[model samples]
Target: MKKFPLLALAFCLATPAFAQSTQTTADLANTVKYRHAYQSMTKLPDWVAKATAVSVPAETLKLDGKSYLVGHLCKPHDCGDHQLDIVFSEDGKAVWGLLSRRYGKTLYQMPLGEPNTETLAALTASYHKNNPDDLAK
Candidate 1:
């Protein structure tokens, strides 16, 4: 019976490592699964695919008492003018994005409509956090 308690403690310690194994931008970028998922949610731009080739991992963002993972992608040479910040649910089941163009002045939410407060908050926060300079513009 004492061994059972030790086993439970071990499992608890290992759980976080497993959770951290969630895929990052670099891991999911080239996969058809991610592309299809995003496309199913909204129109996937041609530049988006190209941007993924230069993808980078991003810090997670917390909003409305929920946590989300942010992914950064940008046009290779023209990054200053075109960029994308994708926000994925912790489980990666849901996805949304903020596309920034013309030096981050123009913004568009994916799915072609105004987003609810939480979503707009998450996407905007993720984008600005990843591109701090854009916040000043």
Candidate 2:
């Protein structure tokens, strides 16, 4: 009886994450290559790097004839609640990005704008429901 309740409790606690995985998977893809991914991640904007709470290593992704690497950001380091998505040039030479979970729409990489689907999916999976405006576009 005791073992049964413990097993049930663990599954119940983990249910929400499983429920949300499908939604997140629909959002996107990226895998960071080991070599130089760390170097590339270091090129993020001053505000972004300083603000990052949890940092995932950079992943190399090819898009639109450009070689790009993406870094994930969660929670601001200042102990405030905020999120960001950052992308870097493979050589650590420059940064390219317009990620979801950010403060504003403007970016240094693509000055004009891009399709919302491409931009928003760059963020964490939870962004989908929270940022309806991003999905609508």
Candidate 3:
């Protein structure tokens, strides 16, 4: 597909070993970059800013011509215990998308489309496992 190159660019900008990073954000999951954006309190569409929030960068991905950060997001009251898919623009200045599953628990990974429940569950487990510091909090 014509979108493949943009995906590749996202991968490269994020990391070469990104794919092998347990299919998760891993060490970079809840890093400063993610925290800064979270602290920035940006929201997508009708989504409101939660009083408590944390983001784990799953990977850098792309949509259309813009590079975006794909990650697991958690909001104490809103998202509860389940991790949700959240997308941020490359500059970390805006929320590109938020797969809150307001209709269902489905998560959209962009370019590739929505992932099945099983895959999304595994990704969430990996996210918690990879980012223990956050889990402890």
Candidate 4:
């Protein structure tokens, strides 16, 4: 009887931990898939819209154990001869700005602005310079 109670207690304790681990694994996998999908899209407008649509998976938990999703969007330029890059992230509940730029050996970051025709034009210009074939749209 004592052994039975002890076994029950152990099982109870292990169950939540196992569930949490499984949840984390699933969340990480989803994050990776979103990252890849964001990378594969060639158009800026589509990329922004897609990034904005990302939501935190149900399995994610904040540091406080509260569940939340964060989304981030960024545009970056390399200072001098370096390359420029734009990045975005979404966790489900909210989006974040993860912009960065390099300026003469220094790095700068700013939030992504709302997508608009003008912004798309600028992105097209930059993309054309970086990847001519991307203009196939």
Candidate 5:
């Protein structure tokens, strides 16, 4: 029964870590922290709204030495031209974004306001991972 107790302790310790990492985009959207951050925007973009409406898988990634929940969201039917990569701090207290749009042969990426250089770089890297062919020239 000593082994059983140790097994129970391990299971309890692992549950939160597993749940935190496995949260999907839909799960984060419903969070109060996420809602507050998103709603606080002064001029919300239309594509951002549309993209979040669709559910996509999310992953926990390390960005700038901190854990962040990252997800790729895109406009339905026009995903090739418009896409958004969102990053939320592990605590869900902070948020950052990268918006990418393709026009003709050129692709443009605009980071939300001025995320730190490391964050912007990580976001861009994450975006490219999602779209290997969509390189930012």
Candidate 6:
């Protein structure tokens, strides 16, 4: 009877480790796919210039005490303006997508993806749907 409680406690602790391992595999695969897509599309117009000018440094940090990789994208001319700080899992799966503004105004958190014409168009439509304020005047 007492032994049952101890056994259950041990199982509970072990379950999280098992779950993390499985999740890591899926995260790794997704990261690889995303990276491949980004690399392939980096040469295309509209994105090519910006992608080339932007630098994404690799760093590890803790968010809510959980470790994550920080990938940054800076603006072309003014590196401090409208910077994007993308948080990814250790395996490179994006966990949090945020747009940081140096001007103290909130910017929309747009989805990140490769610059394929079709993919970009689809993402733009989705972004507009989610954030109507981004529409041009």
- Name the 10 consecutive residues with the lowest summed lDDT in model 2: 106-115
Clash-forming residue pairs, model 6: none
lDDT of 5 by residue, 20-122 (tens): 5578876776698787765565455676865543436888888657798888888777887888888888997888899888898888888885678887887
lDDT of each: 0.70, 0.51, 0.51, 0.41, 0.78, 0.52
Which is the leading candidate under TM-score? 5
Report the number of backbone clashes for model 5.
Answer: 0
> How much is 55 displaced in model 4, in angstroms?
16
> Model 1: runs farther than 4 Å from truth?
1-43, 103-115
Cα lDDT of model 3 by residue, 34-63, tens digit? 766664543432333451456554785545
lDDT of 6 by residue, 1-137 (tens): 99999999999999977774445644654586666765665433332235544755656665446675655555677554444545556765544444434454545444454433533443344334434555652
lDDT of 5 at 111: 88
After the best TM-score superposition of candidate 4, give how far the Cα of residue 111 lies from its true spot, in angstroms.
4.4
Off by over 4 Å in 5: 1-44, 50-55, 135-137
Rank the candidate models, highest lDDT first: 5, 1, 6, 3, 2, 4
Task: List the candidates ranked by TM-score, beginning with the highest.
Answer: 5, 1, 2, 6, 3, 4
RMSD of 1: 19.1
**C-alpha RMSD by candidate, in order:** 19.1, 19.5, 21.8, 19.2, 19.8, 17.8
Q: What is the lDDT of residue 27 in candidate 2?
A: 34
106 Cα displacement, candidate 5 (Å)? 1.3
Clashing pairs in 2: 32-59
| Candidate 4 to native Cα RMSD, angstroms | 19.2
lDDT at 132 for candidate 1?
Answer: 87
Residue 127, candidate 5: how far off, in angstroms? 1.0
**Best of the candidates, lDDT:** 5
Q: Higher TM-score: candidate 4 or 5?
A: 5
Off by over 4 Å in 3: 1-48, 77-84, 99-137
TM-score of each: 0.52, 0.35, 0.29, 0.23, 0.60, 0.33
Residue-pair clashes per candidate, as listed?
A: 0, 1, 0, 15, 0, 0
